[model samples]
Target chain A: MRERRIIAIASGKGGTGKTTIAVNLAAVMEGPVAYVDCDVEEPNGHIFLKPAITAANSVAIPVPIVDKEKCTGCARCVTACRYNALACVKGRVLVFTELCHGCGGCMLACPEHAISECDHEIGVVETGRANDICFVQGRLKIGVAMSPPLIRAAKAASPSEGTVILDAPPGTSCPVIAAVKDSDFVVLVTEPTPFGLHDLTLAVDTVRQIGIPFGVVVNRCDIGDDRVTDYCQREEIPILIEIPDDRRIAEAYSRGCMAVESLPDVRPFFLQLDLRIRDLLSAPNGVQSAT
Target chain B: MKELVVVSGKGGTGKTSIVAAFAALTPSKVLADCDVDAADLHLVLQPEIRSRNEFRSGHEAVIRQDACIGCGACLVNCRFDAIRTVSNADLAWMFGAGIHACNDCDVCVRSCPLRSLDMINAMREASGEARKTAFVVDPISCEGCGVCVDICPVKAISFPERVSGEWFISDTRHGPMVHARLGIAADNSGKLVSLVRQQARQLAQDQNKEFILVDGPPGIGCPVIASLTGASLVLIVTEPTLSGQHDLQRVAELARHFRIPAVVGVNKWDLNPDMTDAIEAAAVTLDATPVGRIRYDRAVTAAQVAGKSVLEYSNNGVADDIRNVWAAVSALMQLDKPKANREAP
Candidate 1:
């Protein structure tokens, strides 16, 4: 059996073309492929892929429910909670569901056995398909604080047997970690500008710390100076493919069109990217697959 | 003091660049870099650290090696897959002599039939790896539910706070700036952003500054919400891309939901003029004033490379556009001053 790889397209900075790379790769790849958009806070892959929703699952976190009838408010649960999700005021345990991490610590801390968990839905994961590509995305309900759980749920929905392409959220934080963790290889998308290089370096550190083999693809490669290229060369990080600053690409992207479909000539770039990732996966060491 | 938080629902939409430009344009104001995750404003602002403090937000679980009986209770109960049984060889390789630390789920303590497993202080025990393979907490994955704490039968489990990140008060050319860095995979960025904002506001008050400009993170998550809360105005920088339009609507709606007025500016607007117009129309529909449209200029990147704001790098059309936008923003804020004061009582 051929090895099935999960490739997470991520960037430390937002709007660095992670979704662009992810959606385009999914579009160009042949055979079985799954695209999971874990950027729950602002999932935009759907706009580009236009996946039709076939199923929807609500993702929830368990928050402590105080049984008032069982009634001895010792505030033990409150003391055990680190998130300040539970507070005891005047013998009343106010359960702040939004603040809860759903760690179930409060339930275990409750000596009276009065605390039980109830599900608080934070977001939803929708599964669908765009042409031959299997698609899934997590969408956090506005004003929801927690996203890692939802991102996990969305990621879990991807088919395990296929090549899974994950579109990660921006930032070098927990949410990005959650989205990109456990991937076989990470494609760190970045721009060639100073901000891009700075954030790209951070993303590289994160992927390196997570012990994953990864490479970089510089978007708008023609626009920014060679700083990103210089840094990548200095650090011995492979520059996989560079997407030039093209106005038509941006226009097509603005209309919610994937580059593979809008710019047929660009198909080879994504194809080469796919081959590069596959080559890296098949290599004994992923770090040396840059060429 | 009034707060103007610059955010983009999408990343790389020129929020930090614009914030840096604004910092250059507006002197003698407190600046806060609330995008604790992937904070890059410091790269441009070049703030010299004045004061630094550790941010110990949450707890991770640790196990005492001498107390651990080698039971697999923690390994089984860890929902985060943070706990794992290390082979003797790997343990030998990692620590010359010491037991592994256990993450504080406390399940092993409760499930230990021999009553040998005990919870140790997460911060202290984890730091001092006494038992190389005995107890361990994967700090990145531990959600701090305290489940293991309750389940510990030997009463060995104890939760200790871990330093998640650091926040700093710094001196910049613009003035005092507040910023923070979240520990790798650390949670509670919203809290950290809140802390930085709190400090920025306090500094503004102390300094008698008129503005508290914030460089907010991309996306409408907890940190973004924290950045937007109680702000006088929100300027959303967006690009002329499809995702940009979609994200702008989402963030604009978020600002509207919070009853905080938002203004929109399209960066790299020349990338797609039609899309820019469409975004402007959408912004109007969302009640977000389309304040400015910056053409796709190489000068922006050149300015960034020069470690200078576009305004300082070039006295060009793009810089003029940024200045015009600031003018509109200041004027809009001036009109809002009375309403804010009226509501203060």
Candidate 2:
């Protein structure tokens, strides 16, 4: 089996064309590729390719359950919980399940060994395909809250194979952190605007904090501010590709078509971006691929 | 007093523009930007921070590694597996901070024969603070329960039931205006937003002002719910991109969710006419009035560059749309014609 090289496409600023690059890059890759759209809060990768979901399963996280029969009510469980999940209220112990983070603190805290673990629905992981590319997507139910667990689930469901691409969520928050955590390399898609640069700085800080190798892709190259390029230069981050601002590209996006799919001429651009990504990966001891 | 938040499910959809424009039509109003994660309203609204503070998220326990005597007592006392032979203060960093929130659990300190474990303030950063009043839960730290929220525990940081943004009472050419800047990532934005409105209401009452305007946050979350809770009226600003239509329906649905009357202002309507119409229709479905449409203006972009609001910039084809939208919103609020549309960017 070929090693699955995970490529996470992330940008702190939304609408900066992260998904645009993710879908098309997969379409242009050689061999069998698996795409994981980990932007659970708002997964739009499927919107472009409109993947017909072949399999989907609800993802759940573990929550603790106290077996009162084994209870000593020592209150150690209450004190051990960091999430404020277990509480001693007046004469009775109260467990607010929503507040639970399920770190197994309370389970070990019980001297009587009363606490057991239960499953709580956190989100759903979806498996599907777009064209010849095998795809996995995570959909966080609105108002259900939390996207990181689903992001992890989607990554876990990824098919082992050729280049794997992950479409990350906007912003350098926890979900973004989770989506890009174990990737081989990260491609930050951005535009040449002050807003984009400001957010790109945050994303750069995040990738650095997590200790990952990354490069920059400036979408809509000619529009807005030039501060993005200046920062990339100052930071010593490599600029891989610069796709110019064109109305035809926007039109294709509006019609729910991939840039490479609609404009086959631009297919070369994705190919080049992919080649550069591979070259960067093979160059160093950093970010060993999780084959 | 009513609190109103402006949010879009999608990003860069002009949520702030509509709020700034709304500030033009009202008598006296305070604004709060709750998107602490990617706050850019200051680029246009020009918030002058009166004060700032350090926001500490959690506690860090450091071990005096050389204290000797590995009695294994600290491990026994530590309910969390955070303490180990290799890592003294914590073998498991993910362990409970319950030591302080810890109900007199001296098990760690007392049980530690080596006396190496010491609990100290962990992660602290200098953050922005202001108080016209808006408590914005830090977007980076704010998470609904069940999703393990990464937070600071040094001080066991819990926000005030009411933390407000720095209050701004300024004189604009149009009328008296109010606004504020929230710290990098505070919480209880709903409460702080209500403070802005209450302050605005008080200012209006003191001055016998006829209106109280507000600039709200984006999206339909708790903050958005708070933004529309008791507002007399709302004006939703949106772009004409595909995401614009998608977000407009969601935001309008949120406004209707809280029973706040809302009006519409389509910023950069010329970017996508068909999408703009779709937004109008969506607003109608939510019973929100489609007030007016603004064309895509390079002037609006230039205005941000000059550090000024569009109203303060050249009154060209786009400014008319802003003026018209202001009129429609005021009319919906059962008011007279707006005297002037003033802005400070």
Candidate 3:
């Protein structure tokens, strides 16, 4: 009866372990969990889960279609477009669907009322279940330049159930924005190198801007420098868990398994991480975790 | 111009690291950070910005309250659910939700019986600021996509080119770094990335440098696509983890999409050798050579703390991996193979 807590794993910097945490945490959630890989351009959670494909669908964005018979070649649509996607060249309107943001400016501007809305397939959305965990992913149709539309589609596929973990796209770009929207908590994972620390700072900044409750999980703790820890401490950010550098764990991961999957003992650590996050989200004061 | 993007689908997979390393390893590669929201390569490369530009997106609605009347018609046609009726104050304060979220079609201005509402070119929130620096470029991605330039019921979204900034030429230790910084929140950043890389190419040609390393932004979005065009090779830096494996596959597949040769380097390989080996196996499937397997070494962190490349750091195990990586890179690019002299572009 309670609202299923939604936790999003996002990083402004890619390769910061957002999906790693998402799939593993979902795999270990005590309650039924739904995992959505919002990184449609490159959905990787399926790689780890190897889910059976239940349904595969394409995501389309609305684009303007010019009815050649109706078009007067007046250049109204071309002039109306701010993106230059629609251009009247040599007395004909040329539409670059990839460049089109589907603003419908040209459709409304046509003197002949020639333009109508058409659907352009941007990518494919895959829906399936693996290991008893519901899963959905988006694969941008080959050469589909835009991703936010697809990311939005995958998020729309949420199971509306117990708990949901969204594995977000990397970086604080539009795709990242699309992935993290409407999530209850965000888990930012990073290593302890300068590269990690630098990117962690950016990811934390992005989460803060999105106005979400988030914490840090420093993986490969022993290998990298302490700058990440020092940054977290200075920023007053909570350090959820420090996953030490261990080769065996690495080997397990390389074999297409979550370290927690191969080693059930780490499940307790994830559980603890989840508890801390829940507490942070439920804090009466709604305090922002300080750095 | 050839674009050699650096990408690893997995989060925290060293995509940026190898990009930065490549920037350092090569002398003339142009650089573009497609990850506008959370750009970090500048932290390592230290590109000096030269220009700043504003990136305007769609228009937000603004209600000009000077005339009068609180009619409900303005509230009826709004599709975005943006308009709200507040207690009647002086006409201005009453309709005071600025255009931050408004679509500005002047629908409210027309619908109001008293003609109290007015919709101008309502400026929406800016995407972000940009600064074009030497060796680095920061293009703020305007969150607004100018979509609201449509049925504002109010005609709110304004498609305007507010002056964001200009390009910059900076000097880096590696060589001349070509970069740009757009005024924060500008749209069409992928094109701007193309512009920066174009400059990098020009600079590399002028210098006759053999390499142009680039640190590509994350995800397979527009900027990533721009970063991938026409590159002789791609070096995908990845980690050995569930996410890393997933990202590696995607980036590899992405490289395949571009039909460019890809090379893989698993950073912190020792931390997850089995994963590292598996990644190597995947790289083989990708048909790109697995250049080097970097160990998870404390020295890497120390080197970063010291503000130096791993190659420039103490000759640690990680450094050896870097050396081996460079050696393999030479082999892949045929940089070491003897060749007949050719005309310069």
Candidate 4:
């Protein structure tokens, strides 16, 4: 059986080409591959991949629906709620569905059995196909504050037996963690500028604490200084690929086209990146070999 | 005072760069970087830290090893799966030797002559009362909800307030700035962003400044909402791409939901002029004023590399475009000034 790998491309700072990398890598790979867009807040992988929507499912979380007729306003549910999603005022319990994390603590604490779980749709998960690669994306409903649950839903809908390329949301917050956790490997995409290096350090710290094996891919390598490479070298992290600053690639991306299909020159880099990832994962000690 | 928050639903749409330019353009304003996760405005403004304060929020559960009877209560009750039980030998490798094996009982350490050095083997042969396993919390996974502390049967869990991040009040070359850095992998960024904005507002009011220029985080989530809520105006920076257009509509929708007037600017509009036009038209339908468009200029990257805003680096090309956008935004802000004051009361 071929070794199935879950590779997540993440950058702490936004717009360092996480979606670009994930789509291109999936586009170039020969075997069965799946692309999961876990950036529920934005989700740009579909723009580049142009996936055909095969199925769509609404993702909802359980929010407390209080029964006023139950006759007891003990306020125990409010006290048990840690998210401040519930409040007792004027002898009535008000439930703020948006603030609820769906932890079910309020329901358990309701002495009168007044609280019941109701599904609140936070986002939608879409499953489809973009050419030979399977596609899954989470689109958060506007005005929705929570995204981690939707990200997890998107990941759950992804194909389990294949090379899963997860394009994580920017920032080292709960959403990013939800997308990248349990992955076999992570590709930390970054530019070489000060902003890039600064956020890269945070991303490195996050993946390190998660205990995931990872490497770096420096996009627009020629524009910024050598600081990113220097930092990576000092940290003994592998530089899987260095893509120079190219206008053609940017223009291709702006037109919603895959770089591998639009620009022949960009194909080899992603192909090489795929091989490097396979080599690192197949090694006895993936972390040591990546270094 | 008026607050003008610059936000982008998609990451890397040049929110910080535009904020930096706005800070340089406006003299009597306080700057705030509400993007606590990846705060890069300070890189351009070059702020000098005047005051730094720790940002503490919520609580994390810490189990007292001696009080725990290896009952797995915490592991079973923890909804976040933050608690993990490790063998005595693995625990020794994780925390190292100097620390006490059990703070209260001290049975494991007292039986071993080498303190905790030989505590693993000693624990194995020690009385059955000694715990063979210890529960530890993963700081990242623990949501600081205190559920584990409430559920601990033996009262072994101690809930301590967590220092999630830090906020800084600094003096920039342009004006007084308020910024923050969220602790690595820490939650509660929305709270931290709100703190930065509140401090900036207070600073602006104290200094009698007329404007508070805020650089907001990407996405239309909690942190972004925290940055823009109750603000006088919001300028959404977008690019000329399908993804950019898609994200702009969502962010603009959020702004409309909050009843905040929005202005839009297209960055790198020359990359795809057709998409730029389409986005501007969409912005109009979304009730956002299309201020202006910035041409695709490599000089923007050059300015970033020089650690300066485009306006500070040179007064031409992209700088001129940004200046025009600023003028349009300022006009819109002025038109809504009376409305803002009326809404406040």
As a whole number from 0 to 100, the lDDT of residue A282 in candidate 3 is 79
Instruction: Count steric clashes of candidate 2.
Output: 37
Against the true two-chain complex, what DockQ does each candidate achieve?
Answer: 0.64, 0.18, 0.39, 0.57
Judged by DockQ cut-offs, the docking class of candidate 1 is: medium
| Model 3, span A114-228: residue lDDT tens | 9998899998888889978988888876556788778878888878778888888766545776788678888888887766776677677666766777888887788756788
RMSD of 4: 6.7
How good is the docking of model 3, as DockQ? 0.39
lDDT over C-alpha atoms for residue B329 of model 3:
72
Better-scoring candidate (lDDT), 3 or 4: 4
lDDT string for model 4 (B121-149, tens) is: 44444424444567899887787666566
Query: Candidate 4: deviation at residue B288, Å?
Result: 0.9
Q: Give the CAPRI class of candidate 4.
A: medium
**Residue-wise C-alpha lDDT for candidate 3, range B242-265, written one tens digit per residue:** 667666777788777877678888
* Candidate number achieving the greatest lDDT relative to the actual structure: 4
- Winner on TM-score between 1 and 3 is 1
- Docking quality tier of model 2: incorrect
DockQ of prediction 2: 0.18
Largest TM-score belongs to which candidate? Answer: 4
lDDT of 1: 0.83
Task: Report the error of model 3 at residue B343, Å.
Answer: 14
> In terms of TM-score, how similar is model 3 to the real structure?
0.79
Docking class of 3: acceptable
Report the first chain's TM-score for all candidates: 0.97, 0.93, 0.95, 0.97
Candidate 2 chain A worst ten-residue window by lDDT: A282-291
